[model samples]
Target: MADVSDPLSLEWGGRPARGAPGPMLAALEPAAHRYRFQQGARRRSSVTYLDTVDRRLRKKGLSLRYESDSDSEVLVASAPDGIDTTELGEAPVWPALAEQLPAGSVADRVGPAMWVRAVAPVVETEVVSREITARNEDDKIVARLHWQEATANGSPTLARVSLDPLRGYAADAERIARLLADSGEFVVPERSLAEVWLRHAADDEVERRPTITAGMRADVAVATALLGFLDAIERNVAGTIDDVDTEFLHDLRVAVRRSRSVLKLTGDALPERLVARGARELKWLGDATTPTRDLDVYLLELDELATRLTVGTRADLDDFATHLHWERTVARRSLVRALQSKRFERWCESWRQSLTEIVSSGGSEQSGSVEELARDRVRVAYKRVLKRANAITPDCPGERVHSLRKRAKELRYLLEMFAPVCDRKPHRAVVKNLKRVQDILGAVQDGEVQSASLRVFAERMLDRRSASAATLLAMGELSAGFAGEQRQARDELTDALPGFLGSSVHKRVTAMLP
Candidate 1:
């Protein structure tokens, strides 16, 4: 973990002697049978350079050596770690790494005595690296360069400076500077950035407005992604607690939420409620993961704050940090135990079975056509909206109204999805009404989130018994402001509901649905 960002003694140009392959080759050949598990190793170090694209001071090229133990081949890059990885995944530059190897050569023999060779194909490796360097205008060391490369063959590789190690830190700074100067200008197009979003959007459209040809394809894609997410969560829960990270947890939660949301919106179109139940299970999983996620967020913020505290406040900060760490440890332990509980495990199995059943069930229900199912969902949501609207008493708080607003929005999204096949004017009118409700409720929800966040911060500060009087006063002021805003938003929502729900536009939209 020591930062490999500084220039290490460079060694290269090693070649394999003409000879028969050894036992390592036999061991690696099986990996080739799997199509993506070729074995290789690399050592890299960097110095200082300017990151031309970011227009910032960055780690420069140091040295990297890749060797295939099975093939006795090597590849070396006198480039920034990021660029070196990028080249492997993308097209080669002039005098490219590819040219350095023999035609059909699987590896490069490089350096004095041909001692090093890059074993993996340039197109099959992913590269991720990061380094810490001094700011261009300040002496302060800060984390700067970070890059991730995912290659065509689905193999991932990562390299990062070990900032906590003193030597690694100095080398990281030197590597950044050297990399900028030595590496040639090579740019990867930004188009790939849209792939995930576009893929999801297309799936959403097909789910919302399925064509005969696209229906099965879209469903399978969505289902597959959902399964992947579920599997990751299951692994995280059943595995060691130390393996969990904030980003991983967040990604898992999002996958679950999106899958549930999509299923809730379109499940009636399927032959059974299996998908619906699966969605409910996902919601349960999300709820189970919430405490650990909240603690993760708190720990991150605490770490950030700790770095900025003065020496005089060190004792108090240490005490608070210890308390937070204890809390996180307990939460993680509880989460792991809960995940292993028979009740939770049974639910997970059932959920997975439901998904498998739905995917296997080939035929659609009577109401399976996209238009019909969309209308049904819209009407169902509308009924809930009406019920909530009717129950809204003057005494109801903003939180309740905000919940209603979400229900209204769901109804509106469904209607809009089917608008192409339905009466557009009526659908648009309903959407407008829904928007009005959403706006009012959204304001209230924002206030609620801010207020809750402030309250949590205040409680943490108080628990540490180190909060300043000024901070306490500010928290009180924030709470009062949020309360006032929440009240105003709730009143606005209530006052608008009568006209909004009873309007001629609303009635017309409801009439057109069925």
Candidate 2:
């Protein structure tokens, strides 16, 4: 491979139908006696780009694609100062090879993030090009250029010049760049080809949580933040219903949960009637998706779960895997039905319209200044967590920790919403404290759920008489392990409670509030 520093690209646009690369190259071609120019026949082909649904590869300054009529894929990575390395692979989907390419370089990145994401053509382009090499008197190649015309899907055609200079010929590359820039009315474009392609190919907007501006009215800012989440719920419905990807369902559930949290955190600042209605509908959505999501999690972790048993015992889990697959199919069908029903449609529409009205409403009785409201909510939530934390003894049931976890989550949400208004340093400290409590609580809760779920699944398998006794035995072992872990997590929570609800954390919460 040649040094990345030796190549330069000069891009420019022309009337979609009217430019000839020959004329551009002619301007730079030298007198026959002084130098030699060899031009290859123009070759035309299409190029298709591959990337994750989120555009992760492009974000890393990498262009990954397979050219039409070609058997290999190429990844072109660019860095600062006009340096780039292009790696080619024989496989069309190159995750395995890319993970190991040029160790410690950017080329070796992104294979892990691509897990569960299908790499498909997000954009396509047509190119007509010719390669020209300039050789000196001794026939040693001094420089090379690839001049091409590229047309992105539904975009205007454009001209491009790629210059590759031999070592010690950096000045020659610069001169070639100038010659290309001067051709016709060539000028640098404000956007890259990838940007243009992405713009044209982009689907609907992906909703992002809004950041509240400081000093904004409490009701207005809270309403805006909640609306951002509402938008996500609405945007994700079609994708989730269509089963485009697991992420769609996951993101939809998150939006619904966050919306419910916002209403709870704000308390009476939002109208009572509005909060009650939204909470009821959001709860329905959450419950409706639970079975499917649970099944998704189990199915996704099946292989890892299988590895937990000894090699011989692992084969006994085949029946269990089959049962999970059947369950997922049933759960997914029910989820899809709910998502597509008229009731769900009406609920989403009503939720959005009602929230929008609330956000736009004139000064109302329940509304208060944001800072005062935030302080009241934060202080109240913090007190509840502390009270719950104090009630738990070392021997308390895991359910107690789970309840405290819920309270801790509520407090965390409150702090997050008020972060822009509160003292940043203390607000972060308060949040950090709450998160530690939540993490331990989460682990305990998850273990309980998993262990209970496994027991139920194992019984169903036994009742059906579909699984061998070995399968039941393996499941029992797994359940015991989960129960033990759950107990350990409860112990951890008990030990960590003091620092979490202690005076230092109390002071941080007090200092955080406006």
Candidate 3:
């Protein structure tokens, strides 16, 4: 295994102006005294690269592959230069490993995009490799050069040179690159193999998300940000349709929710018709995804949820788990069907079609300093949350706290959307406060959801006869546990409210509005 962080090679090539890899290497032979070139063996093999539907691995400068010639089918993770590899272990079947990579750096980095995205052979090319060792005057090896010609599916595709220089021999490598360039042997191909494969495979490129500035117009800024998110939503729809990972639906739901939030937050600035239509369609989209996502949440948390019971009580929940799993599977099927429907396609098209005129209709109504608008909105939202928080008593209904939670989320989204344009210190302070409040409220809401879910599951389990009496009893105890936690969260709000709505944070919020 090679050290993943260490560079195995360096390379520079331009368009192949003339001749093949052999002639290119032969051209460099004239300077044999300074570069003693010894020809190594010729090797040939087919290499296949794997990537997400959207090419997430390639976008992050990583390439994953399994070389057929290797003894083991372990997926080798490598950089673009094909030098070092981080072996991700072997699976009897390639796609099986998709569910096997743990939640470590590799998973965290690319898992969200690839969640449910299938890993298949995206690029397959027969590569003929020629190796040459360049030695110093003392006959010590200085650099290793490889010339490779790749033919995709029996058709000549591309050729390039790679230089693997020994330690302290970087200068020698650069000289070699210069010599190759001066001879017009090969043109420098700007894209990697993965990038080339992506271009050849599909006409799509990764959508660039927004980074708003203080100077942009309000309507344009909002539209720009929303459009970026919409693009992501469209891209992930296919993966969601395939039910590849829980994240596909998760991301799609988030984009829809965020789109709705944008419309509510900037309703006055955007075109009235556009806002109305977006709200309606986005609402429909969000509603369609809710059942699946809710089911996903329960399924994802099942392990942790099981731990809320005692050692002996854990087995009792098995029947309940089966019931939930069956329901989740059914919910997943419904969600997949919805994503694949023509109505969903039309909705996406309608949303995208509205993009062109979203900013045009506002005219003078939307004209304002974006920074001022952001500040005013953030100020109002924060104050509303503060008022709502203050109104809450220990005896207040759960609905009041839930409403306050919604307000806090609204405020947090506004601050986050405008963060690039806002003052760092005050913006961060307000966001920090908002997050604490949101977390507590979220806990409160989650507890309620879990308790309600347990009751519902209990009834369904009884009807289905999937759950035993022991499981039902365990669920009752679990539901009580959630109720207790909810009470504790509500109690903590007394202390949490003073800090979140304190004079200092209030002053910071006011200062941030400037």
Candidate 4:
């Protein structure tokens, strides 16, 4: 392919009338070297734009499409510089993971961006087009033209006629472009066909963060922030209900958890009844999602956990893996039912409308701005974490460390929500410090929980006769490994906690507060 550095340098798209050669092509203007046209019957085709649940491919500056005609399916990847296409012998089922694609450039390009997430059809459009070949007297094709029109979700889009100039046909291209420009029936569009298709997609809103402004009202700002989280929950519902990927459900649960934390930490700015009800409703959502999410985590990590074994081979966990899948199937049924329930549906709607109303109503003149509220909240939460950290000793119960972890999490959320108001460098510095501590905390927590959960799983497997004796023994070894890993993480925490507890860190945390 030649360099199309400027897509508009050729003024190619024209809205032509039916049956005629098209306003741009019909006028032969002043070209002595005439071109003949061969038109084919119009046909229908479809292209489905696919990406990770998080829109990772879009972020990486690429587009992948599964295009289908009457018989064959092809996967196409396009960027500004060029395009690559590969034929898929057959179309894979939807909600496809990046790693599942056959080995090729397209898979290699998308795999890193997708990480663990699955790719699904973000936008699907059907197009009908008439193919026209413009050729010289030698019957050598000079250009390929398509009178294409598309519809997405039953609405029309990309309604235009376009021409692709063949190599070594510069004179014909220039002359045709001049004719179109002079006719004034065609104008240069800023976006390409793919951009236009994605523009109308419902999932185009990838950035979930609410743009909270400076000096916003306390209650209104909190509501706005919470609304963003609520939007995320609603956005992930369809994917989660469909079980598109574990990440979809994971994202939904994170949003729900964030919403709960915000209400618990800053609900005083809003009415007590509203805060109470919102927290209660979100708690139900969180509980409903927890079982499936827990199973998803184990299933996703099963391969890695199996790799860590010396006492048993990877094949030993085959029965254990099967048991997990069976449990997850049962758990997902309950989860999907809850997600599709009227209670869940009604809560999301009421939650959004209520929050939006509060935001529209504005805060009282007597109330402080969000920055002020953030300062108070951050200050209090930081001290709580500090107090808890200081109280943790070498032999303190696991509950104490867990308490500290909770306080630290609340502090982290406050920092993130109010980050827009804080100094950029200071906020990043504080978050960096908090994230380090949080990582160790997470290790400790996951270790204890996973170890206990493994024992329970082992018991259930035995009761159901679903596991071999070898698998049960392997699970015991895995549980012991988790216990050891937890011990190691605690030791790391003991060595690292003092740095975070120091005066310089406190100063940075204080400075980051709005």
Candidate 5:
């Protein structure tokens, strides 16, 4: 694995004048060798850059691209392991899950970072490239120059020249770099071609969370938060309706959930009728979206779930996969209809206008500052969680744990939304403590729900004769996996409760909340 961090060349923004020696290389002063500028190789390749929804790879200082021409198709990674190459039998389809790609070095590199999210083309550039080498008197390659013209749809054409630095020749590379800096006609750019194009393609990037302050009006804060979530929900509607990818629906559901959470906690600050209508409509939207999203989770995890089966071959579950697909397809139709219905569209428009009006009006004077109101809510919500946690017994049924989980989640949301007013260190420590326990609770709920749902799915498959006896038995094993996982989480939760709601964390939360 190679870790190459330095840029191979000093790239300037524009092409040089035609039929003329470019300004920078013309000024290179070779100490001991005569310079030779001759054309080397020319090729045209289609290049596409890829990233996850959150730009995970780019954040890690890595870049992945697919370059294809007549002779070969390859994945080029400018990654921590230097420049890595993985050959592909054919070009990959965009929005491909990591598992869909062939198992190799590239897949191993990117799969874990991508997690459940799909990797898709962030930008595509058609590049016409030609290389020119700078040779010394010994015919040794001291340096190389690249002339490239890249263009993408709805973006300005990129025409640049770069000097490729040679190893053990820092002086020569420095000479070229200085000459380029001195030239008035050429200047360096801060961002790479991939970064520029990704920005160009992302036309609808909006901040998902609202900015709130302690001294801000309670009604304005609530309105601002709700409005932001409304935009996110509206933004994802088209992608969800079109079934572009699972994340579209996932994001939509998150926005819907956050909106519900905010209103449930702080709806007292907003108009009563408006709050009532918004809650009703958002709940409807959530219910309408539940079926397909649940199936999507199962389908996404089916491959890994199959591997957990000890009694049946993975192929035995092929019918199970097919059944999930058919169910997702059918569920998706209902989801699309609900999103496109007249009621949904009308509610979106009305909600936006109403919230915008409130934001513009600086909110009603009846509501107090967010600091005072949220402080009370935060204290009450924390005590609620503590009370619920204290009531849970190991022998208690799952419902007690579920009830506690709900209270903990509500407290979590309040802490997150009001974090701006809290002391940074203690706020962070408190949230970390809460998340540690939340993960276990979430796992328990998921395992319980999935195990029960798998049994129902198996019953359906048997009734419809859609699955063989082998497939059903394999499902039984998978269900047992989920049940075992649920049991493990319950045991883990027993140990986590004291650490989360104990005296140390209690004091930290009290000191941190506004």
Candidate 6:
């Protein structure tokens, strides 16, 4: 990995006057046609060189050098804290420039004919590292690099770039070659390049301005924090099972769920693979903790409700509690087995790999407008919630519905997160409708849980033979009442969903988000 703490300068290419090719052109022609400019503080100085290498002729390696375009010579550095070629990729520097290409010109022609120069002050560098271990039958090396650098001044000047194959040279070589060839003819306008670099310079000044919305800051902060948190969780899971602290594990599970929910609710601003893998890990963690958590909840409820029962009912409750204890014991054992399972270990490994890809893909650094990203995330979340709601099974336990309700809440929260940047009225309306859906689901789940508890008590009394005919009759009546409540709750939930979604308010909200 390049040192990010030193100052650096990078200069790429520009068309020389028609009369003669300049020294810079002479330096660049032998190398790849594309060039990159980077300059800034220690960690912030460097230009990314994507697809600059030709793989077909590996024996002959190509490297970039800066030449004097007019007066000054292009400078390159390898400071422990300076600029390096770790950030470039195949994505066009100026996407809109492509549209401005001349007839028959492969590259887009836009902006200034003058030279391109880009510079920024370094803020930070994120590094991901791993060790290679010999397994039963496989010898593999693992390495990853993902980083974000912000300008010295707190501005929206953060750039995330993925380092090319840090381990597999052959694979990376081939990939880079293919990317360059496939990019066709591409040209970047000097003005656009200058604009991007200038944005970094103005970052500090912008931070001082009051017009900069708090919502934008919050969104960036949350997204950055999430990336770091997920990285930590992935590392812990991959390296050692013992490292998985209960609280940390639980929090990671929640974070994954929350991030996914937020992403879905807002619309997928991030990459799909990251969101999908995070959701998968969340599900795995949920499953791993389910038995213990479920038993814990059941026991708490049993203890609380037992005290409120009449003496005869108490007896029934006691028998039910005993059965629950037995079930809990069984569940605990099952949970332990699962935690130690080879499958679990493999799942963790897979998750770590997926997370590595997401972190290193430079997906976070793409050029889309932030507002567009946020709106997309909200839309995605809404769709996910709707799909989950529609998929609810009658046979699923009350706990399932409770989980779904929680998901709905997350989606609502995400929509609210985007309300400021995008239109809020529609999001507000969607939230209102979503709240109705959540309330109905909540009621249904509550009724189901209560009814299940009552059934457990009834079965226990029948098994123990401790109750008289009168006691049995009373228990039967209680069970019948609980069942009625459960049915009513379900009916309400079913009847209310369409209205909640179809209302004019919901339609308005959907329009806003979309």
Please list the C-alpha lDDT of all candidates, in the order they appear: 0.48, 0.70, 0.72, 0.80, 0.78, 0.44
The residue ranges of model 4 lying beyond 4 angstroms of the native Cα positions read 1-20, 26-44, 70-72, 79-84, 88-93, 99-112, 126-139, 142-192, 199-210, 393-395, 502-504
Candidates in order: C-alpha RMSD to true structure: 16.8, 5.6, 6.0, 4.0, 4.3, 24.2
Best by lDDT: 4
lDDT of 5: 0.78
Residue-by-residue lDDT tens digits, candidate 5, 78-144:
6644666799997777777778766787788887777766677888888766677777677778777
lDDT per residue, candidate 1, 1-514, as tens digits?
2223333211111122111124223322322222222222332222111111111111222333332222233333333333222123322322222334433322221222122111222122323222222332334443333322222233222212122223436554444434432332212222221122223333553574322222343344334444554665664452224432355565566556655655677654443566756766777777877777766665666544444433333344454455557767777777677667887779778766755665566543443554455556667777788888887866876556776876776676556445555666776767777788888778777667756876776688787775666555555565567777877887887798887668685577666664
Weakest ten-residue segment in model 5 by summed lDDT = 1-10
Q: lDDT by residue for model 4 over 105-132, one digit each (tens)?
A: 8787777888888888888888766767
Candidate 2 per-residue lDDT, tens place, 180-238, comes to 56664455455555555665676323324455666656677777778788777777776
Which residue pairs in candidate 3 collide?
Answer: 13-187, 13-188, 14-187, 14-188, 15-187, 115-245, 116-244, 116-245
Error of 6 at 499 (Å): 7.3
Could you give me the TM-score of model 1 versus the true structure?
0.45
Better of 5 and 6 by lDDT: 5
Residue 369, candidate 4: alpha-carbon lDDT: 94
Which of the two candidates, 3 or 5, achieves a greater lDDT against the reference? 5
* Alpha-carbon TM-score of each model against the true structure: 0.45, 0.78, 0.76, 0.84, 0.82, 0.40
Task: Say which candidate scores most in TM-score.
Answer: 4
On lDDT, the stronger of 1 and 5 is 5
